[model samples]
Target: MKNITKLPPVVACCVVIATVLWLPESASLYAQQSTAAACLTTSRHQLSKSGKQIFDIAQKRLNAYLASTKTNRTNAPDEPVHTIPVVVHILEPEGRSLLTDFQVHEGIAELNKAFRNQLPESDGVDTGIQFQLAVRTPDCSATTGINRVYPNNPNYTLYGVTSAGGPGLPYDQVYPMSYWNNLEYYNIWVVNFMDQGAALAAYPTGAYSPFDGTMITASYFTTKILPHELGHALFLGHTFARAIGGGDLDLIECPQNSNCAEQGDYICDTEPVNQSSNYICFSNANPPNPCNNNAPYGTVLKNYMGYNTFGCQTQFTNDQRTRMRGALESLRTGLINSKGLDPVVTGQTIPQGISATLTATGCSGQIQWYDAPADGNHLGSGNSLTTPVLYESTTYYASCLRADCPSDARVAGLVTVGPGLPVHLVRFGAQVTEPNTVTLNWATSFETMHDYFDVESARDAKTFGKAGRVSAPFRVTSGISEYRFADTPEPPADIIYYRLKQVDTDGSYSYSKMVSVRMQEMQKITIGPNPAGNSISIAGVSRNWDIEVIDARGMIVQRLKNRFQIDSERLPAGLYVIRVNMENGHTVARKIIKSQ
Candidate 1:
């Protein structure tokens, strides 16, 4: 990542300070306490300037849409939900800094909970929007909706920086390496933000820029940060943006009773808030700081758009929801209705003994087959795939061999293994029962000529080696035979893929469908003040692991058994990796950006 040079001058406005966080800074910037107030001001201002024409048009369209829906009452409980396809690009240093699948799953889960109003509060409104992991890619292949890139080019991480060469670069120059079609999918880049910013986003303005997307740091990706950024992408603004500039603007009324829509965030339900101070918390134990001039409602501290603490962010107003929906229907219609490429594999559910021919298409290059959706062992490479007699329901996918198109976007074919298959390979699956331990189970009915079953494992689908084997029944019978095997994975192993090889008495054999399980992380540790100045704080675990601070060259500069701060005041600005070695032999490493 490039070091931040200097921030360009931004026009002074009530929201001017709100946009200041995105400015480039050196190490000295870390010493200053950060205020969460008015985080959205900068983007809002930028959009209003660069996209004024489109924004006005979108506002008019939103008014019309809402007016039409006023009498129709669109949000019926039985109405089918609207879904927006999303593609996540995780740019980490090599594979060492990779965010785990479980983490991304949890992040998306939280996003769903917030959007569906599933959170524990009546104020949360269902935004009438659903975010789905894009199943198909631009070349029309299957995908897990997540793309991980360990870029060879270092320039990929300089987000928000312009060509003048500051600590960050514009999204067009920095993010195009992994971005999908902005029209078809909502692109989100999870990287180590150069500015130590929680996140940043671009608002919808009818016209699509290649740089149009949201950028968030990995640590903040799991919080309300997702919805907050999505809100910007969907054309919503901060609830208190009006109070950003100094004073003497216009409409700076109290929250108790005022012209809500015209005064503050342009939403009637959201009370006006003064952005002069940050609200650290909204709980009874630590209430928000007093509102400016003692406004009756204090502030709209609990709204997602407010600069409230992460834990306090809860809901969006009905008007905000209406505005976002209107934007989706108008400016973002391409993303809302896009159906990328087509189905590469097509077939219906069938019994285990049956065979189905699957075809791949829309790829300029060859195609490879995988049993699992994202990263599993490669089954084969060809224009088509024919299945062998199998047990258990399986999802088969085709991958486009185009170098530019690595993630799958083609619709995967689901072959349902019904119970009627005679092989009765009945059940075969794998799971992580505990840290480092994976349990494999399988059952067979009427063993017949079956000799033994070798439980095989692979880090990827292509490499298969025996973990252990279970003996088959000595005699043929109609009763079901159950078998289980447990194995402990060693260091650096986070996920294990397993399959079963059923060998017959005469040495004939058939492999079962692949199943993959992600290992539980030994411990979770978090490092704060990430772009650290003099020291960094570590938490989550009880410091039960050995800590090592390593520089870019893979040399450990400091080691400790149990300690909090890794003092780096004497060190120069650069990228560093903190490796935590647990007594259980599990090793975890995270990338940290240090400022100069």
Candidate 2:
């Protein structure tokens, strides 16, 4: 006789790291839970109840402009593409803003490429608009085009700046203090955090205002996001827009033949789409919300204005291009007519350079070695530069340029010739090993003023406590060192976090990037009463596998499938072998004795 119970449905496995959850087997659940709620909320409603009033006025202006285009008094067919000067303000908590120059440059470069249809991943239609970093500041002083602002207030977030029924200061109080002249430059605020989706942008109000820009999370300031917000800045609404009391998909009506401009998105070329708040179009073999009656013509999910993930979106339609151009020519002409523009050079660095072999990494442009960070003199250019032996330490900088556009620049780490180099960490990573142990590994090029490594762990990356510690060994000049620490906590959590605290002898300390490791449940079996009187019991058995009982001489006595308990009372009092085999190529065996 065998005892068995039906197995319940597996909920699937998940791993969480630094508040980000990865669900490989639960696509629907992931899509439902992870898709941002704020992405679907239109700024028209978030900013003000009368936000649509400005939009209506802009639409009328566009209609008037289209009507005038039919006359014989049209301008020349060829017109120089207009460029908008941009300024990026990075707001972060004190000692927490770790955004590198390369990251900022990459963000701006991606924006330009997307607009120019130069990005290889998109079937982009050129919008005939361009963005360049502002070369001059408000006072006409030269700038590198990037500004870093450290707000001493720890609760500073982009969303907190607006008192839109939230816990923060009002926009009028914050904008005037930090914003540039709305008539001259397009300002982009990259804060350390955002409560909304990846970012938010204001629509064109046909008037110059201080709150005329976009605010985005520094983490999600990617190629797709920048263009999407820029689309909003040009008065382009989302294709699947939802407004007040219009019902679902009624903010802009469903397209009917030639009335596309009057319907969804107000664009004649882009097909109408209505994605719900939780909809996500991931770039998998099967896309979410496949073509159906709701979208008989199929959704233009690749449009920047759609609520698709970064991977799924690729282009903007011709009508969107026309609309953006119309917004620029008519209602938003002030920006186009503004003068005194300058180029922005990002990734500016002030290095304490010395005479030694130096290598520059993480750059996507041509490398130019400079004696000074700016406007001094240029040295030989390459991916790496080496200096001759020197009696004293000297400074050097590197500039990364893609084509004619400046990408990023940084000072090489100080190169000490004779004594030794400071503790230069190369990389840090973590992995899971046997017996549910997590091993952390880190390496450094050299060490000076270094004390020890403090290993830290946290269940929820927030409350980190010390797990272990290791003292740094004495260092030698031009030598590399590696260290490892294995954490064997009892019954570790599903996700484990680790970080290295590099403390100096002088009590000053710095931290390495946080690394996470995932622990999976391994199978095990337990049996009781090896020398039983009349019966035996089996424990820790899984129903998804098969189990067999055999006599001592290897003769099969009994077999069971999807069974957890078995009766040994009928078997003769002798030694027997119990074997378990799993479908996933795992086998376990145990010896048992039956007694009468």
Candidate 3:
């Protein structure tokens, strides 16, 4: 599947509003009100006062764990330590609809970076915490280490956890959390998670239902959701709450409110801001609310622990550091100190240019490759062996083998090469221009074993029936390479999507993001050459509507209310949206065709 990009902020806002409008009345009310005493509301999944009490009990237990650590230095090292083992379970359609190996590694890198304050400067926030990836242990230990599993049923259910199944697929559910034995590792299920507006949601760390484990909605084929959910898996709660009585803060409530003072996310430091707020950089004008104090209502929008923009959110608070440490010390010990992770996987490495040509055979499962010494970065994954290079020297490559159950398990491998090598193909790009020909291009940092490239086009992006094939240049002088192919029989004049399929000598095949292109005759609307040009008649109306002529700046030029004929000899040719405001408060808008 292609990586999903975030919708524009304006578009996202509209989606959110539209979603709310379609929600059930009960759900809407539940999202609006906040109660001091936990009260089960329709929209919120948490129990009312009873649920709050249970959460309080858990909090006390966690607090006690922290207190014990403070008093006894038994397991405490000389320096503050933070480690977490994360497992990603990708649930997809029956025909192996999982994400690429690089996408998975990208997700992991994002998670560790956010936790360790090592994210790219582009992410914006700079938390002071340093998180280190746990080393893989010998004996192929199977604790709470990272594990990816696929189920048979398209739509499976496990108690409270239900897969929101995508279109044309059945929902998958997991029953009895006991089915999963790696309780010690943080279990994160990435699947089709979406609500009305496709907004992402995750349970706070340590929060879990008896029947269902922690499930996070995968926004695209990326790891943004994982880090966000990991935060919840680490015990962070929503930044906004509902207000009850005369309280100054909002508690954890769904449908976030705009009020900042009344909703307390339980974190004393996070400003008591309302829901639906955007991430604003920290400034003297907007200082951090150390205690959620009413007089000082500034916000910490840059904090990763808060609900901020994925790009803008970069840091975790000191309080979050303390809490996460405490949680790791108590409940997540096995996950934090797992023996299966290799230290080489977590540490930084000087990226070497493409060098090695690793091959896989009889590997009926999914294969994943990652860049080593580069923080477990993913390169590519498939049945075949391929090399992918990174621009930065701090990139490492690792790969995992995945397969269908009831069949023999697949074996995966990981290898690293030296710097200055050609970059490998991680993704492909293509655009279909003509019926019989397609334009193809691929993206890769390093190229060592890249045998050839195949150009595939299809009527539907979901499935490519294979239209044409092209051979990739054997020797790539530079870090990047591009190729093209023309199919013998031109595709029909219709919408066609194209993708590049990169193959290795070992027969493993990786795919690139699909590009959509359409070939159609532009419908032309002719206006006048009639009546000696005294007055021109408009023709070719797609729908019934009155037309108005507007200038380039949208100022009304002429209104054609009742007459379709206009004196156009004095008017110049231009473009405009012939808008028809219907009596039903709906508008039928179309582009207008005009003649000079």
Candidate 4:
């Protein structure tokens, strides 16, 4: 992280004064009376500019598509033929631990469920819609595919893209941002993401492609991150941005009201919401309340796009449907009405037990099954056949051969033997000690033979880097295991987040819930003789602790190893974080002002 240079002396003074004046009476009084002060900062400009531009371009494309179609209907066309071609890029240092085929399939399933209102489980809302999977092409080609690439760069964290020049530069020397070129394919890069405030973000409508533009981030790869980013891909912004100022405050979870006031989310359909403080159950703590003198506003925390617990979020509004369709028409023409690429059949054969409807085309005299128990002696003229055998707990494989293409037999997709287990993050004790190190412990339930774990940390919640890894002990059945790791070089100020990654042997992976720790503030100890020329004595309530002196700009100036007295002959005056590593696993941090 780069330090923000201070403004000119006069400018700095003005900013300080302005900041003080802008503080409310309560905050101002607290700052004066309280031992420590909290400051409020804004990143509206830093993070959103790029997103805004991408959205504008997507919006224009959508508008153009709508104008050309001129279709007159109230709702999005039913099961309208749209097949978006997507390419999933797995970016990781140890590429083998990236998402697996099953995980990717699950993610795709979730994507389809959200896109079409076919999710069996809805968040108590009725969205009369359905999104059907487009039939495979005669080429047996799929619109979506996953690709894995290893940067082998240590600098690439588990989150966010790395810049060209930095400590972590060598790992991603040839960064992905530079190689992105295909605009037609929805390019989703699943790498380690970091930053502090947001889980995911997409620019200009959040859509990314091989050509034109791209939106890359790791947060969107897990949970419902893909759907949320896809929403941006289709032209949706944060539901709760202020009408006058372009920023979202609360629009996803609050009480519902019929005020007709355009305050919440700016979209009339979505209910007003409060900020998310915890990730637990879905039912909103605060119900809908009236706003702008309109009807009461209700909470939409359960909406898939809202910042609710993954387990709770599940639906999309009708308005959102319109927005998505509009985007498809305008910016994603490749997604709509793609058929005949693969043929689908529906039939039953004696042994295969409900055979997968085959999609092969001309050039074959008849389809034959080799080594197929019941179908071994049977032959078919059509592309597919259904068997009566039910093998739910067993793996199955099949291939299709054609006379036109001699060496062109297609292998069927891999089918799992049994239901897969749901991966979750489990945390242990939450205590800190000295040397600025925190012992992190965790466990996983519902394990598989190939599963493993990775520990990650972040300075800002938006960006994260791998800290360590723990191979998951295999489980004969569903079970759990406890593991621990330590975070070194603890930061003096700011909160830090830690999380777990469960990886399967086949490379599929899932993320556990995130945990955060705030360093305790030490304000009681005083160790200065104002503008001390040579020596200073650390005197206050006694506590055996080590102290490290840093400059005003967060640079370490000197370290006093367990000593209460220090000679300051070689030091200049400044500000720094006085860090105290406790004997336990926790740490305490305080700001120190030094003058010479």
Candidate 5:
């Protein structure tokens, strides 16, 4: 039995986390029997409401969303592709705003790839939402979507910014300086520093006055962050921002008894998550947290909406894609209709260390040169321009003379940056070897000031313990260093997260990107095992099980899929998430247990 209705916000003071709710502005709305309205109205916090018609529409959406969870339905294939124009504003100081045009372009590419479901490991559907660098300014002027602005203060940083309206914030002073038509373009501000959060965005609801678009921290910029923030702009919420039941109480999302559409993040396809940040890396095992509490278990993840690791944040669900598409056609039609992806000048690509001359032939006024596509560094004003030395690939945008009035779409020039040596972790993965043993492996591109490697494992991603240490190789093997570790001494967790603590000879250290694997998580699935985490026999079916006995840490301790019974006697006691491939070409992850 699924429950509907949920709490308004964090009013109940009993919820754990992900308790975000959009409350009405009206005091009486809660005064009336609006689920847990007594908590909200009784306190000073009164939900606001501007109109009743809007409330009715929201209710209808909630109801339809609620019905979506129980049944499975495919979205219409004829959904039109949505294209949005984007502008990234980079603020002052070289130390803080550490983004390059090539990186910005890469970020955009990642966003598109995630939306289109191009990731190989992901099982999500494509949401036809696409984004392109805005070729034209608000008044139909030629410009790249990237903007580079230098404020009066050298160490200028943005403070007091929120996702919604901010009346007296410093952004009010900065908006007039760097703002374009918010209705026409999706603006993004890349500031040196912000006190609010890593990134914040505005939803499609038109209710938040004076504040629009997204603001992100330069340090936290990634393919994952931009896509997530934009999801909010296109009518999406955090995966954890749901209640267990629909508006019944102000509680965080839980695995059991959830009304997905209304109470949860307003979507059904994505399984309910507990602490979103805890379940970041679920797919490959080193999940930040294996959260979903009920039917769908393990690290039930793949969507960008979850507060998971960037590597684990892959795609959007079909339901999420539909929601975004609807928002484009209905709520954000103006931005949709804008000439964002219009034709620009034939872009030029030059090799690294070489400068190129970009020419805009048909401009009626003097050409304004920019480093990025829309809102980037302003080079100078000229028809034909010479560029600076390029170490990395860069896209330059050009506009017309007038700051106002309609001009043609911005022309673009691209300089291809040369590829540099790979200095980061190439692969950090783990796999189960023989029964009761797990092996961790890693490789690096090249090491300069290298010393030794420390393998770290964590039950949860936050608190990691050093597993073992290995010294650096005598020399680079095949232009890379490969290392392996077999865990004879392991923890008793359902999943294990692993990362490499790379220590240079100077004692300075940096950590590699985290990766995870399932261990003893199978506590209650298919295998007939001890309740404490030991498998004894197969309960139902005998042959064709193809079961790999997974322990509590998500590691496959034994393989007995075809036969049902394996060396389950050797498995350690705990939970497990094992892959159960079925004869119907379907697969399921069931909890298994081993008898003591």
Candidate 6:
């Protein structure tokens, strides 16, 4: 960050000697503060005498729209949740993964929680905007939303948009090669710069600018940093963006009239104030403004658009939401139609009794399955999926994940399981019991008319006979009803077959696909070839299993759900335990010895 002496004479603000960390000798003037504050004050147009133009135009558009009707703007759909795709580009030297996959994923997750106002620390308005990691790049290839680049020159650096094409011209070349579709995806460049400490953002007017996006130093890649810069990307100026040249600019500059909307920050809700040091969050009792007789600027200093100490920002004002969403409809309308965020896939239609395997083409990464399009534990990964025997058609959500960055949107991919059944059989399985004994498990959802399940058994796959009956739980209108039946055949047999006879309350009945079982076969978990080489085949587990491979030190080396095999080539030569967990809450483990 730049030193105090380098600041322009007209851009005078007191300097706070409050930093405890070391700032690079060549950092930007924006990076003078400690890590707790983002360089939110460093937009290209922010220091311009005419920097507030984005806000000025936004206000007139807002008034004109509010005057028109109660309807949502024609460009944006108000009811359905909107998703803004984000792509993180981490540029660093070779041999270093500066931003780990987990860090990027966690940051994106927190970014959404902040925008949705769901974070525990969030006391601000939910912007009604959801930021998702992009599943596809500009050229339509799958990605983890996190992209890494290694320049031939180890000492490469990128300045903010203000310096994109200047000096060495690294930003100009790097951005065009690294950025996803700007309109479809929000690009955030993460790097370590010789002269930058925190971050800077581009306004919507530059949505198509060659360097259109936010750039932040790696040290400040915290949860709130991106959100604050993105607030500028959506056209929000700093809460202290405007100040008077020392005159009675009271009611005219603050929350007093419509003129205030045309004044400070161009949002009347944010109290107008003169610029203060990067530190000290005003209590509003002592206004940051000095020209208006120290008027009380009633506000929460923790606004995301403020330069207060980091970890202190928690909210966006109501007018801030309007300005942002309004920009989405007007100035930044291109983002609304960007297809970069779509996590679409090729679905499948299978006959009754089989499972469907969906594929997200062009993904050179793991594919994840979700029960819903948003907010839920992932059902499994790799192969896109492995569902239990489906008696009824079912739909699921799928996204390609590279580096833990999922196509983080709630895009649905249909997977038809069966021809069609009245009641949805969400789960169906059989586990071996004592010797030849077997326990059957089945679950159904949305069964308001279901009656009971008649357990049927047979010596072979075809021609079944009744073994027992399990009464249905009181028909739950909106939940799943599970049933279990244990069959103990006379004498210990080698193998047994089982299926469900689902009889409805109305006397209609359907027969589930026959599931055959062998004695002690399904109970055993196997990992081989014992002293394995490249990959290990995990045999004997069904589709509902979750696996965790732990090294001898008890550290989890690999984890994934519902897969028959795992790539063990990368695992260091050592002894490891493969623990298999079933959906019925049953768990078993087996030891594997990897050879050098």
Q: Give all TM-scores, in the order shown.
A: 0.49, 0.47, 0.41, 0.42, 0.45, 0.49
Model 6, CA-based lDDT: 0.61
Tens digits of per-residue lDDT for model 5 on 1-596?
12222332221221211112222213442233111111111011122333223433644654455344312222433234567788887775534545898888888887787777776655566786778888767666668788988665533543422222432134444455587666667778776554333554555543323346777766555646677778877777666543443321333436442466554566777666654343335444343333443343433355576555556566677678767766665556666656544423444554345566666533434678877766767788876678786677777777766444455446666755543322346677675443345577787766665678888877545468888898885444447667889774354565566788887666767676666554542222344433633335544442244665566654666665466545545555556655554342223344544445
For every candidate, C-alpha RMSD to the true structure in Å: 25.3, 24.1, 24.8, 29.0, 17.9, 24.9
Candidate 2 residue runs with Cα over 4 Å from true position = 1-49, 70-79, 157-173, 242-258, 277-299, 340-596
Error of 6 at 79 (Å): 4.1
C-alpha lDDT values of all predictions: 0.63, 0.59, 0.43, 0.45, 0.56, 0.61
The TM-score measured for candidate 4 stands at 0.42
The residue-level lDDT of candidate 1 at 412 comes to: 79
Best-first order by lDDT: 1, 6, 2, 5, 4, 3
Which segments of model 1 are wrong by more than 4 Å? 1-48, 120-123, 154-163, 167-171, 244-259, 276-280, 285-299, 340-596
Candidate 2 structure quality by residue, lDDT tens digits, 1-596 = 01111111110010000011111113553344232222322332433334445556667988788666522211111223667777788776555663676888888889888876678776856776888677657675667668777656644643344334445433334444467876677888776543333465666666766667777767667647678788877867776654333423333333233456675567766655555522456344443332124443333767777655656567877668777877777766656634325221222112122345555542334567777767777777776677765545566777555553434444544444333233567788765434366667789876776788999987645468998999996544357788989888666675566788887777767666676654542223655477865556666654477778889886888998867677887999888867665543234556777877
Candidate 5's TM-score reads 0.45
lDDT of 4 at 45: 25
Candidate 2 differs from the real structure by a C-alpha RMSD in angstroms, to one decimal, of 24.1
lDDT of 3 by residue, 1-596 (tens): 02222222322222211111011113443243211111111123221344344445656767788766542222211223444445555665356545655676676767667765576743322222233322232234334333445555534322212224333222223323222324333444555533222223223224333222344444442534345445555555544433342221233223223443223444555555543343344445754343344355443566554444455555565455556666555654555434333221222222354333454322223545554533455567653434444344333333334332221222334443334322355555333323244445456766655577777766534446777666655664446555556553353644456667767655766665455543331122334443223455655444344556555666777676545566655655665434433221222333444555
- Residue-pair clashes per prediction, in order, are 18, 1, 84, 81, 78, 7
Q: Model 6 segments beyond 4 Å from truth?
A: 1-79, 157-170, 194-197, 246-258, 282-297, 343-596
- Give the least accurate 10-residue stretch of model 5, judged by summed lDDT: 34-43
Better of 1 and 3 by lDDT: 1
